[model samples]
Target: MWDYSEKVKEHFFAPRNAGAVDGANAVGDVGSLSCGDALRLTLKVDPESETILDAGFQTFGCGSAIASSSALTEIIKGMNIDAALQVSNQDIADYLDGLPPEKMHCSVMGREALQAAVANYRGEEWVDDHEEGALICKCFAVDAVMIEETIRANDLSTVEEVTNYTKAGGGCSACHEGIEEILMKVMDERGETFDPTAVAGEIKKPTSGLTNLQRMKRIEELLEEIRPNLQRDHGDVELVEVDGKYIYVKMIGACAGCQMASTTLGGIQQHLAEGLGEFIQVLPAEELARRAAMGA
Candidate 1:
């Protein structure tokens, strides 16, 4: 089990504000794409007093995120609009007594939702409509700074490489093509000394360095070609990696999203690996997710 902070647990159990408001003057909805946590905050305002009358929240999230939303509603109720807007992520964290680092973003989300609600009350859009800077990390709403730090810290060999290290485009994958373009530009300017020929070598079979995007494409291609064949047997397969010439595969699909996935990944996986090569390693996707979770 994760070591949740005491405050997180407390809020999870006896959350401060866990209901809907009778009459809300403004409502704000915020969604986190990475964790798929969504929240709606409603505020009832007193026009003459220029203060909040009541606040409530409806949240869909893990324990910490839900707790953060609950706590936020309690803190903001009866506060003036500007006063509520002054509440920060730090204040939320402090009010909760503190949250886990991984859960810290939940506090940020609470603040953003409150601010957005107030922004809505004032009739303003939070996001810049006109183009300013390109999205550098699609998975986490990260901008140029996040990508730049990863590139500089690891001296990234390629964009796909960044994915393995940071899990940037590992989700949804819509940002991969754009990420590729961004990395190339950054690397070119960062004294990589571009040469078309050697650069071409780096472009092909990038998994040698555990680069991210290329390997994802390669594995995705391997899955696309091979999975269809396995589907006939009512099985599943996932191509993971090659260690020294040994190819690895994991089973999923009807197998994983159902009860008999274990039997399929085990018995059927070996059968498929037998035909693939002697060096093939076939395992369950759960096993893979486990190994990944354990940093194996």
Candidate 2:
């Protein structure tokens, strides 16, 4: 059994504002029985002031879900609409002293429902595909955009944290690999270390169809993808040679002599390894020059 915090248990056992608000100006509903959680939030606002005069909720899920919804209602009760909108899943968790990581999604549900209600109240229709990209988690109808947004917003670094925030890998776990890929992509976009070792499963071996030239082309393509990022800081990289499984490259401009040069080289190696295979090594020009000077 999970250890429920005292505040969580108190809210779960006796949820405040547990019913619907009469004559609510705005209402938002999200989740489903199939998804294992649902929330309906109704708010009565002082239209002139746009202040949330009262808030109420009806949640259908576990104890955490109920507590989350109840906590959300209490948090937004007297705040202006704009201020209320600023509340996040983390805010809900903090309000309840804290939540178990696995139950974090319950707070997410509360936050989403609140956003929806706010949109509905404002008569704003967001027809845009907020959930663009391929569906990655069929069990919860979650897409790559949802997972990516959750990961970036929460600074989620592990598969478990992603699962806790978005419920992406909480089902049969078939989509865990895809989730991992998205996590890596996000980390790369943020210019962070892309640690393949941190992820579960072995690094995939290069397939037989990849010829030597094709593999080299792939490496160049990946470097080209990273070139713009380096250029932003008055830096660049040039490919010196692709010798067998080794890639010899030289960093240019600011990146060449920076203390982070090795870190940059390591990042390149990790990126290529993620695509090509673990055998691919990226060596900086200085490292090769030192080896040659030593006559090794």
Candidate 3:
């Protein structure tokens, strides 16, 4: 079972703004039932002030999807349209405390709905067509442009992370290479190295077993290599615990509350997996504690 946070459960069981807003002037619809997720967002904006007077939504999907949509309406209700447009997928996740890594795509869907609604209000052409980029994920109808944008916004480095945030490489396993190429291109643009071995289907098994202490030492060394880059951004990562395949770390400084923290941890996990020649997961220390407290 997915370990849902209390806030997520709160919104899911009794979703706020669960229906269409009366007298809504803007409407945005995204996703399809065929894709297993869909959302319709309605907004009543004050024309002169351009502020969202009211917002509501109706979504079809899992609890995370419903909660994300509910949280989105609450987050944008009183904000100016311009500010709402600046809200990222990470913002929605943060609003709900956090989402399970596997369910991050639900937050991404919410962000897209908000953008579509704003564009509708503005009478701007908001096309979901794959005209700007190739169709990368046939299963999810995720295009290259969306994948690239999500990677850049979240600092995603591995195909698995991309799947977490965009659902791009999560289906059929055919788009893994395409996703890897996109990750490589984005990392290259950012002057960061992309480890091809980090691709979801290509990770190699550890050649030899090491003691827990040796594993911890190696993980620390790998983290030290990436510390400079994170430090430059006023963020840092601290090793917390090593439990089997899970490496728990604490994001310190500016990284702790960062909207992109999950993907930052994803990047760290990718680096460690490549260096250690093993498939491993990196998670936040807080998340570990939360699960333990819940007995999840």
Candidate 4:
């Protein structure tokens, strides 16, 4: 249940340029039924001036998609072909006032179709100028080029923003890690520095001079904070004891036999490290026992 803006509602209900132009010299098509959206864009261009004489669209998508295609045509009409190349997904969204975050992909579709149509007009192969990297988001068949372009165009920082603009990590969520990698890479390329874990809400370990007893107390406090989330999954954790930098813990309840116990343990350890200090390490009861047996 998304709230469509007045302009979105207007264009969706009565989409302008809803049909294609006959004998059009340039045409671009993108998306598919399987992808949940499709668009066919036809352009009539002045051969000498290279200005867009007319633009029309045949869109097969949701309300936002239709509005986006219609809006794109209106924006590019009477503009130079070179100028039209600069129109971004954000521009399309802005033209329609603003779109809901989830519906931003519809605008992305418009930009892609426009690029394709322009390429067709030039008699050149469609080339993405944003990214020349590997395919990261397989769910929606989005590659790094599309994701990177959207991020750069909109200055997106968070995974949520990437998902909003490109629909990359929105499905299945297996590619979230890959999306994060690309985000960091792009940020680095822009000479911006950030704590990589900050996107996931992970705090970097702070340096603090404290006694062993104080450190143990702090670890207990952090564990208390994380316990509630584990409890919701019928899982629980107990502090065995703190030995030097190693904070040993025992998994109980469903967590004890859960196949994902190791993953949960790693998450807990990472949380502790971030909250306390990187020096603080977490080990399971079994690991502690084995280490003690080795006399090391």
**Judged by lDDT, which candidate is best?**
3
Q: Model 4, 15-119: lDDT tens per residue? A: 887798867889999873333798999999999999999999998898999999999999999999999989988789888987875576788789989999999
Please list the C-alpha lDDT of all candidates, in the order they appear.
Answer: 0.65, 0.78, 0.84, 0.80
lDDT of 1 by residue, 215-235 (tens): 446545645654654564345
lDDT of 3: 0.84
Model 4: how far is 15 from its true place, Å? 1.1
Better of 1 and 2 by lDDT: 2
lDDT of 1 at 38: 81
Provide TM-scores for the models: 0.48, 0.49, 0.52, 0.48
Stretches of candidate 1 above 4 Å error? 128-185, 189-296
Candidate 3 per-residue lDDT, tens place, 227-293, comes to 8857744679999988888889999987889776766777788778877889898999997999889
Q: Would you list the rank order by lDDT, best first?
A: 3, 4, 2, 1
Model 4 backbone overlap count: 0
lDDT of 2 by residue, 1-296 (tens): 86789999999999999989999999998873324788899999898999999999988899999999999999999999999989987789889987775576788788888888889899986232233446687654467887999889976666755764555675667888998898888887888855645653236766525888887798888888778757754589998887666788999987889666765676667666766765678998776778779995
Candidate 4 CA-lDDT value = 0.80
